[model samples]
Target: MSPLASLTTILTFISVVCAATSWTTTPFNPAAIPLAVRSPYLSAWLAQGAGNALNDVWPTFWTGAIVGWAGFINVDGESYVFLGDPDVPNASFQKAVQKSFEFTSTQSVFVLSAGPVDLTATFLSPVEPSDLANQSFPFSYLALSAASNDGQPHAVQVYTDISAEWVSGDDSLTVNWTTTVGDTITHQVQLEDQTVFGEVNDRIQQGSAFHSTLNSTGTTFQTGQDVVVRAQFIQNGVLANTQDTDFRAVSDDWPVFALAHDLGTISAASDPVIFSIGHVRDPAVEYLIANDATQNRSLFFWSQISTLDDAITTFLQDFPNALARADAFDAQVNADASQISSNYAGLVALSIRQGFGAIEITLSKDASGQFNTSDIMAFLKEISSDGNVNTVDVIFPTWPLLLYTNPAIGKYLLIPLFAYQATGQYPNAWAVHDMGASYPKALGHNDGNDEPMPLEESGNMVIMTLSHFQRTGDNSIITTYFDLLDQWTQFLITDALIPENQISTDDFAGSLANQTNLAIKGIVGIKAMAEIASIVGDTARSSNYSSISASYVPQWQQFATSSDGKHLTLSYGNDSSWGLSYNMFADVLLNTSVFPASVYDMQTAWYETVVNEFGVPLDTRHTYTKSDWQSWTAALVTSTTVRDIFINSVFKYAADEENSQPLGDWYETLNGDVEGFKARPVVGGHLALLALQAVRTQTAMPAV
Candidate 1:
């Protein structure tokens, strides 16, 4: 080959590599996903739009939820109270996140009008529109009242309040309606002050903040061009201070471009927002569900967390005795806080954000008199925070509380583990398939990963089960499931080859053939199982496991390193070409007693090298990293810097960034924008008991 041609080919190859690596998930926006999150509340967001949508931020709950059409969107500025039991079959609140949007467009599809805008909001149920808490009866009002230069009132198009349904069951009554536009605006119209509750909404016209000439609670006005308007209900006097006192309550704004003047010229130059609103049910437990062309659905995490946090705060008001006060809080604060503060809250968050649920239970009971354990393992794995199997086809993974928080978690953990032994039912194996990538739903490639993950999963199960036994000191559960021990051992020996491609949770970087880390994990799993078998007096299997584990150490080292430096590569290459995070768990998670301490140093160095403003990126390629894994990886070492770096990583992702929803999993690194995923249980586990706290065993969850 010619020298110039060779150089040209090399240059082309280098360019291709750079190009592929340069692309962020959504390449255009810098504030795009992959940065860090500034909002911390998203960590607890788990509500799947039960009431109003959630917002993401410190002030707001999650970023704003996509309530409906852009025109009829509500801010995450409202507060939500748990009115009914979330654990109940169907639940609703008397007053929560008090807010709704009603919009109408004079143009094509939006409510914004270039010439004039008038809207009539009919309450589904009304009762003189007096007390704020008296939402039991809806009320009606007119807003966004505007007119043209011709000195004529714009057409008042009235719409129904579709949100005024029963708290749970189907019982929606049309609230009483009233009009206080012209003459009524000058008078109270036998109702409370409009300004007291809140302004209907702030009005603006074509980038112009429209100043209202009419101050009545329900009145109309004339405008020269298309305008924007906001409306809010009135209810603040202590006498009138009712149950529904959230600020998110307000009407929608109609944005339009301009109005045609007598010269036949368009003025103001604002783009009219084309949008629509409608009533619809949630999608079935299926994919590719259709959405109202005008309305989009976005789950809120930030807001959900805040509301939950508020509930917890309320429950903790009588701290040192939350469970003792359960009955009291139950009636006053009630199941709202209890339901949200417990494991269910975490689980709900996980399912929405990541797709699976995991727990670490302590073997103790709370004041509620409930004792959760291994028998409930399968349910624990798929349990949503709000309480139910997710309709979606996926699940997620977790970290410390390393699947070791409460005994309730144990019952859940064992469900899937024993299913494999009893019915050979691999479907609900309570253990994880990998480190959380579309699970429980078991959609897409996750299904293929199961039986294929024999060693990885079997080993994990053995370790977890043994850990549970050590913590609880109960050998009976093990005795009852000895047959599972046999199958698991065989699978580890025959199926656990370590190319790392078909390895455990560490598959995110890509496939590595014959990975040392996995091999070590396998050995540990075998040894741990052997210890269990010995405890049960199964001497034959114990010896076999010990022999295999003893021989595999050298092989682990052989394939993980090449003829280069002492440090390990991402794979078995002389290059030692690396990745964002290092393979530190090689000796750590496996409980390897005799590995080099240098491994920790080298891994920490690798972690440092991958650092970004948001966190250490997934690899050298980009800025974004997973908050959950950062916690897990940090748990392996004892360095405060290591621990803090990972902790701060999660902190950065949680506190700043896009969609300030209370908590969501995926976040951006460049500008701290929230990317995807919300309120996952795995994140709770990741955040709840990181580092040394992992190995410690507590039998039950902390009191509420």
Candidate 2:
């Protein structure tokens, strides 16, 4: 009898030996677990649901489009699916029982029981904050290791495949692919006709998707229709080692590239079967520079490496060291965050990957088409909102993670904004809202027609510039952009006091006049400017900015304080209206002392009284709150009890099974349901407490 036909005899015995399935989570259960989240284009997640077992449901792009990634294991003639849904019709192919799931700053691990053997699948997206080359490489790793749970030898084989759905969001798009064999076995898939810098439903319309594994013994490869390929492995414990020649639409026959490894028999854990998946697009962004000429900027990794094969080879070889670095990074973040609370640590761990996933580090090509490594810039997408590029307010909230990880990253993010505005292309006196309306395009608003959040963006720029300088102790950025910094600071000086009707970063909440929270941001911005001036040895401007900011504090208090002096109002003279004074965090962050101890105490006490099951509301106007602002509020509060209260509420919301999407920053505080927004980089603000701690530990300021 064939091996598949003979497996029926042992099916009854295998079923009886298998234990009951149960599920557990380490740290806390997140809404959707990150699978392979690197760049915005390369992100994938496994949405948590009652029926969504690891093998039962397919992994999805962050936008909820299915990206077909499937895995299977054949243990002693019995076949089971583990990582994704393979949709095999055979009655013998069973779904593996997931035992546990855990995540850290850099990796997500899922443990599953496949009959008599146990499988541990780890999805690692390296978080190299200090190492730009490794961080910029658009690849994620999937390592699968198996061992016999019955303490007996068992024949085992592992298989994984990626469908062409990963190449483009539009399933009807025609795709062509090829297989290459050398030091590594790689399958490359791409659209037949590419539209450079174009996107359909946020998935780049250009770029080749690479699914690769080392060309080693016991490994076989195949390409064909998904069902055909998956069934071949189920019937036989190995692949046909052949490529399908047809080039067709992504949805036509559901073409897939697959690799399988045969572990003859295993009593102990077998060596890991590792696969690397990445999407590569040259000339990653279209950027407008000081000369008013548009230039194509490629990913920074291309500058350091000569070829894609070499890049993949080095990346695969560096896995041991890369994983070690990521492990150390996760441990450090956990250690620092646990000092606050275990709940706080979980929040930080969940936010780290989502925060950095929105950014891409790129280098500009010179006249000869050679990438200039020195001309590097980092661009961020205002994901799931408007798709704005390098949005000042978006960066403002995301900067905490950048600041805590590597302050130089924060500097790279700012360079594009400064470079664009420095050319006098932006017609606004205040900072532009964002470099571009959509991501991967940094064309400046030469017509001065960008969205107007004059006071908001102005304050954000000044505060972030100072924050970067404070963390890195690099005064060069301050002196280099002193003129434009003064321009934005001057705008803050004019509008900060009493504040005209304008929208803040929480623009979705709508515009308000004399906004108590917005007014404080501008005031703190002026104070931050004063420090920036001092750092550059501009004593005249330093004293002037200091005097102005010092004078605005008492006036701001008068306009914003409640009748009972127990809390701050939402707007001037609105004694009955109260809101989260998150802007006060910048004062504490900068050590400006602009808002006195009484202000902190009053806000802390009032927040405790008004706290909801999920979190404190953004204001009395709505039950919804912004998680980023709530975290900033948590960092500034003097009461540790109040701090934990805020942290626990956000943590509770994140752990809610119903809140299943990549962490949304805006949600209803009453029910912990997402109100609007998802997968935003602003969730990085969740690390505010860590950034604040780092800043406070600096004993001496950098000399001028």
Q: In angstroms, give how far residue 483 of model 2 lies from its true place.
A: 0.4
- The TM-score values for the models, in the order shown, are 0.48, 0.95
lDDT of 1 by residue, 1-704 (tens): 33234334333432332122211211011111111111111111212221122122111112332111101211122211211111111222122221222211000001222223211111111111011111111111112212233344332211111111111111121111121222111110011112111111110000001011122232222111112111111011001111221212122121111111011112222111111111111110111111211111111111122332232222223222322322232232212212223222222222222222122111222245333222222222222222222211112234333333333234344543353335442343333343222222212122334434545566666765665566557776688777776566666666444544563443334545555555555667777777788888879978878777666656655655535544455455535444432224423543544245665566665555545555555543345566655655665655655555555545544433233333555555555555555444446435333223334423332233
lDDT of 2 by residue, 26-130 (tens): 776677889899998999998874225577678999888999999999998889989787676653598899888889989999889999999999999998877
RMSD of 2: 8.2
Model 2, position 565: C-alpha lDDT score: 89
Which residue runs does candidate 1 get wrong by more than 4 Å?
Answer: 1-399, 402-404, 425-452, 495-497, 503-512, 562-566, 579-594, 619-623, 666-675, 685-691, 694-704
- In candidate 2, stretches whose alpha carbon ends up further than 4 angstroms from where it belongs are 1-21, 698-704
Clashing pairs in 2: none
Best by lDDT: 2
Error of 2 at 660 (Å): 1.9
